[model samples]
Target: MIPAEDRAEAGRPPARVRHRRVFYVPGYDPRSPRTYFLLFSRELRKFAALHGITARMRAGKEDPATSWHVTADWPGGPVKTTVDCLSWHEIAVRDFAVPKWRVALLSLRVLWDAVWTGTVWRMLRLNWKFGIFSLYPWGMALLYALAALGLVAACLTLAGAVGLPRLAGLAPAALGLYGLLRLTEILDRRFFVWYLINDWIFTWRHRTRRDPEADARFESFARRVADAAEDPSLDEVLVIGHSSGSFVSISIVARARELMREVEGRPRLALMTVGGNTPIAVAGRQPSPARAAMQALVTDGGMLWVDYFAPQDVLNFPWLEPVAAFRLDLGGKPPRNPSVRSARFREIFSEERYAEMAYRFYELHFQFLRANDRHGEYEFYRFLAGPEPLESVTREPG
Candidate 1:
């Protein structure tokens, strides 16, 4: 966090009437935090133009110790947004584009866990929920399997052409496999099957058993949240989570609140989960830490929680009651549910642009953060930098 006195020196316009500090937790993306920095820079400028709001953004220096900060000036406010991208890309990079043998072994492990734990049925339900988007993983698995088989066949053909004996063909097959793997690496930059599997593996590890590294990371993130919540200079502390981050955000907020008890006079804390895939991750799991965290959040009365989903994106479950899905007991009373809001992407994009990217499921899932083609409701920029409080903004539909 930047000190109030140093904010002006950091190139932001002096002081403002209100201050909003946003902590963004991105989903299973392996990209650097710089990716988000650029995205915010582009979208904030467009959002300001589209809404006719006088907004100016100053890109701050990236610091791993304090996280990436972007200062935005809007009506009645200059919001300081920090992106806490809790990505294990370092772990993902180790095996994401590795050889076919490694990926095959990992996929088998994921499938076995899903089957043994009855999560396959849960996956089926998720597929039914998200339609084609949910089926993408299965499709990617099949595509990779078929591609490997084709490579094997091509290797055998090359072996025959060279008049090699039976066992001699194995070497050519190995070389062909390596080539195919490299090809998939090039292709996966656009179509992220391998990268998706990396995400699934992380989710699977959390679902089945505790991952020590991931647990430590979450705890560290929660501590950071607690620190921000306790900051006296901040007016509001907003935690925004997208996609797989929704579940992680829930856990972080829950843990942060527990730590917040130590700090008196904490700032207003709010949670906004967009394009959330919590249900998919928690599916078919019994009483677990994730469920416990969800229970804690839904039952907590202090903070406001809003969940945003769009029907157009098959990656997220829209209008789903997370408390009910987690099967948490509220002590025989009605529980407070998160404000489930519909995010209309079609309204956000023009007809031409919508048609162009409508079938691109992954792109649609990210509409939550991108600059809207036309202003309707649910402006991402306003939610972060607007004058209205987040709780009040979500109270009225856009």
Candidate 2:
């Protein structure tokens, strides 16, 4: 069983953390790091008030991304954390910069590849809601396209009925259709059609050897984690990756392990991924370095990975067990590294609060990173800027 890999020494909880280093890799979002700084800083205040503790965050160098310091005095003890958020918004904006028409065409091609290659069916079998979510943007794109074509046909018919030359309506019909298509683009801001398209395109490209430069960037993040791990004063080097950022975190942690020289007295190195389903990037027949990295970390005994899975969230795959789903070749090692834990969100929020955000999928998907209404076992902000070491917080199954 996977639990066997983490038993005994490998699963032993580290000492209560005093000084910690936190690395955050946000999802494929183009928002500025200042936004995340505000999100976390505000949430820290809410957490302190709820727990009746003292906690504060001060911004550090915050240009490309934010570097901040957090000090929290929980009932257990006082702890200080240095938090660094890796920024890739410039790269994301480049992906966003693709011509809208090209994004649609590329998205169609990518979607077709997934369906033609049985990727969609595979994903549906894994988690139906997530499969539907994957198809949501393209489905809307097709709907709007059909609406435009039907309007053009109606315009042409009206012209012919009035006894004008059928071609007489061509100019007006073309203009009307163009206006309708432009309206579709305007609607995209509300639906995030092109934005989701860019995310899938990036994921497809990253795993298919089209985004080697991103890997080059990931290596720097890995080196940073490795550097933090070797620092004896820090109790833990914790990396948190959410959404597609999970894709990068998996590879970086694996690469960091490779970069780290075997040494005694190193701080515990750990990872937490929220919103599962990242395996889509590397789940095909073709071998990929990302897939290889996943296997190494899942089977490795040195580090801990807790996949925070929220079943009600439609944006992520539910019930994903990578070792079983990906058919990772364990090579006789116990599958113990990733302790999949259910994020009991319903319990964290009051019934009214839960119902209010239940339909807001994006808000729910992001709840993993925010402070809960009630202090539950999964106090994310507490675990993040904390006296609690990752190992101790995640050692027991939730």
Candidate 3:
């Protein structure tokens, strides 16, 4: 048992808290928000059963259209948390709605610029695994193009062999090209070649800060976050960013901090990024908005930042320091805010469970947001619905 005086020595949050507001910014996913709602509900039940706690989801909120309130009665105390999905689902839908030809051309431009500007080589130098991941979409795109061109060539050759005029070959050539494109579409249902191309297209726009729609959406998130921080009822405001959303969340939180600076008695602000690939957007020697956001967050020094990583998750840059990778300008002083820590899946899960999860790459990436089967330091459920404050639990023992 611990004494009250010992709580501070144990690394409690700077302030006492009865409630927390969690704003979850998901990655570039087009799925409905209801999917996330159900996933969280199911995971919360498992988390409660595993920890022997009473965590009840009262109901879903219609005002925000994707929010839930949960109450957890833990060993520490009864705490309430409101989890809001700051969704850009509609924007993703718009991306998918784009004409196929335009998406192809735009994605081609992203690849050409990466190659022309030597970004792909730079990426390879930084981390070969992720550099290869970056190349996959482009590689698949080129393969499709080559297949289409080869089909046209074959059709022309057959026409010549049959004593048909060159002009007559155009008809069969067009038809063959259409059939090949259709076949590729069918194949893409499995490979997701075009889907990945669109995803990278979105990432490229964000990297350059040229997407006005994204900028406008970021502004909306900033205002919402700033309003939440000023709410007197809330004791903590935690912004969660995962995968592609990590960079977006950083921009929103940084902008929101500036908006909330003049307010009085604001809630404790904090940022937590899980399986983040922030360097993908914010890196490089070029000055961009994403890079600027990284710099601003550090200079402001108003929020506690925590980054969680896993080496097994190839989607994220594991076993690397992000600040150094992003090449952030910090006046030659080591930034003290973000406390990077491992999720320790190997230490927490049994061998059988780990083996079952191995080779299923997407499952491993999503593990950061799932419940643990055994005790661990960084369980996603415990981080969100558990009794401890984000900062208090993530802070290092001194």
Residue-wise C-alpha lDDT for candidate 3, range 154-182, written one tens digit per residue: 77788888998656777888888788778
Report how far off residue 27 is in candidate 3 (Å): 0.4
Count of clashes, each model: 0, 1, 0
Identify the runs in model 1 with alpha carbons over 4 angstroms from their true place. Answer: 1-17, 59-88, 95-100, 126-132, 150-164, 262-264
For candidate 2, the per-residue lDDT at 358 reads 91
For all predicted structures, in order, the TM-scores are: 0.86, 0.93, 0.90
State candidate 1's TM-score: 0.86
Model 2: ten consecutive residues of lowest lDDT: 4-13
Q: Rank the candidates by lDDT, best first.
A: 2, 3, 1
- The superposed Cα distance between candidate 2 and the true structure at residue 218, in angstroms, equals 1.9
Residue 100's lDDT within candidate 3 is 80
In the predicted model 2, the residue pairs found to clash are: 2-335
Q: Which candidate leads in TM-score? A: 2
- Candidate 2 stretches greater than 4 Å from native: 4-13, 62-64, 162-168
Q: Point out the worst 10-residue segment of candidate 1 by lDDT.
A: 2-11
